[model samples]
Target: EKTVVLITGCSSGIGLSLAVRLASDPAKTYKVYATMRNLAKKERLLDCVKGLHKDTLDILQMDVTDQRSVLDARQRVGEKRVDILVCNAGVGLMGPLEAQSLDTMRQILEVNLLGTISTIQAFLPGMKTQGHGRILVTGSLGGLQGLPFNEVYCASKFAVEGVCESLAILLQHFNIHVSLIECGPVNTNFLDNLQAAEPGSSGEQVDARTQSLYEMYLQHCGTVFQNAAQDTDDIVKIYLEAIQSASPAFRYYTNSALLPITSPKTAASDGLQYIKTMSKIIFSTNNKVEQK
Candidate 1:
């Protein structure tokens, strides 16, 4: 029996890549339910699969933010059970906190935090009944450590960490595993897709200092992505590790080089070290550029 894998956010990025890889497995080991918020965006996924996945792949419309849509997608699953549930649906928000509107923050939280919980909730009972399952979440570095200009995004991801950690303890008894694939920057359209606050675009006026810092942050982001961003294929290899392992860990880091940046958070119990280190890592270069 092929593993029934259902992944969200299949329109593009990690979700789309994973779906394509698993569906095209040489042994035909997986039946992939690749879902996205809009069916209109599915052509990209289809084009990548090359129309040969008739039996191995199926596309469904699922907006993780909408509970009804999640439930409806579950109903459409042909296998009637999801052996591996990949909650890869999420969005990013970036800007100074003062510049971000309340509605925008809520939207990020709804999709990144609540959307994940809702999707898992829809399938939790079925997994428990089956007595075996794997829950995989696409996590972010921002989720593990704070980042400038991403307050709301970090909050939502931090909440997901709590949710998964708490659930892992209980799910273990049911022969169900929950794992988070914590990623650094990846080569994807995520930067373009995220909602970022433009200086002076919002009603509130952000202070000049914050604006300068935001610009520095954006440049820092660009440098980091260009220098260190992993491709989606690299991320997929890590996901496969977790999936194929007999005992998957609760958290898997995709970019180990980036892991040290998070260590200060744990290395110093006071937690101020991470903040200072991250600030220096990101802003120090810009600080020098400005002086020159």
Candidate 2:
């Protein structure tokens, strides 16, 4: 029997790739629900998976932010014990905290953190009844380490991290497993669709002080975090393992960095290491070459 796996945010990137690969695996069958907010925007995705076996993939519409939409999807998935649930739907926001309107910040939290909670709650009851299920959430490197402009997005992932940690412990007695996949810099529309606060939505879009600081911070991030720099195959492998393995892990990290830095201890150490490394670099450079 094919494992019934439901995944969100399957319109593109890692979610889309995993759906295609998992459905194509002949050894392990999967009734994969590849969900997206707008199925109309996913014609290419639909075309790409057309060759897979008819039973392998089912495209479903889901908006993690909308309660009605989620409940509707839940109805469609009714009584079918989900073998694995991948909570991958989320948005990114980048700017100074002050530049973001209160409403915008609230929206980010609603979609990323609250939406995840809703999905878990909707599916978890059936999983518990079945006596086994795997829940994997998509977190970010930003969750592990705070980035300059992604304060709200990072906070959302941090919230996810804590929730997943607690859930992993909470669901142990029920034989259900909850895990988090902390990923870094995958090539995705995630960056392009990131929300920005409307300048005039609030009393002001952004005052001069906030706007100047935002631009500076954005510039620094651009210089540090190169676009599409990481190999994503490793991350997908981790996801497949989470879904298939009987003795599944509680957490995994995927990125260009050789060491998977996802744990709270690792995150803190990385921050301290980064500061020490930068200080050394500055001092060494100053000693080697005088400013021109």
Candidate 3:
């Protein structure tokens, strides 16, 4: 019997790539339910899979923020059970905290935090009943460590970490595993998709100092992505490792090089070290660039 896998955010990025890879497995080992918020954007997923995945792949409309949509998608699963559930639907928001509107922050929390919770909630009972299942979440570096212009985004991701960790303990008793694939920057459209408040546009809402810092942060972001971003294929390999492991770890770091950056957070219990270190890494480097 093939593993019945369902992944959210299938319109593009890691979700789309993972779905395509699994569905096209040479042994036909997986039946993938690739879901997205809008069915209209599915052509990209279809275009990548071609017409050959008739038996191996199914596309469903699932808006993770909507509980009803999540339940409906679960109902559409042909196998009646999801052996592997990948909650990959999430968005990013970047800007000074003062410039970010309440609605925007809520949207980020809804999708990144609550959306994940709802998706898992919908399938948790089934997994518990089956007595065996894998839950993999697409996590971000921002989730582990705060970023300069991503306050709301980091908060949402941090909440997800709490949710996954909390659930992992209980789910283990049911023979179910929960794993988070913590990623660094990736070669995807996530940067494009994220809602960013341009410093110029924010005008008086953001003070000049903050505006300058935000621009520096953007530059630092660009340099990091250019130098260190991993491809989606690399991330998929980590996902496969967790899926294939008999005892999967609760967290898998996609970029080991980036792991050290998070160590200060743990090494210094007060959390001041991480903040200082991150600021120096981002702002100090940009300051040097400016001096040159």
Question: Which number leads on lDDT?
Answer: 1
- Could you tell me how far off, in angstroms, the CA of residue 224 lies in candidate 1 after the best superposition? 0.5
In model 1, the Cα lDDT at residue 247 comes to 100
lDDT of each: 0.92, 0.77, 0.92
**Model 2, range 1-292, lDDT digits (tens) per residue?**
7788888888887788777777777765788888889988677667767776477877789999888888788778643678889999889898666667888989899989999999899989989988988899988877765665678998998899888999999899999988888787776777688897556655655668667756766654554457434545666888987777788888777754634332544456454765444334333335346433
What is the clash tally of candidate 2?
A: 1
Report the C-alpha lDDT of model 3 over 92-188, residue by residue, as the tens digit: 9998888877677788999999999999999999999989999999998888888988999999998999999999999989999999999999999
TM-scores, each model vs. reference: 0.96, 0.84, 0.95
* Candidates ranked, most accurate by lDDT first: 1, 3, 2
Which parts of model 1 have CA positions greater than 4 angstroms off? 200-202, 286-292
lDDT of 2 at 172: 95
Task: State which candidate has the highest TM-score.
Answer: 1
- Looking at candidate 2, the ten consecutive residues that score lowest on lDDT are 278-287
Cα displacement (Å) at residue 46, model 1: 0.8
Clashes by residue pair, model 3 = none
C-alpha positional error of residue 104 in candidate 3 after TM-score superposition, expressed in Å: 0.7
What lDDT score is found at residue 30 in candidate 2? 82
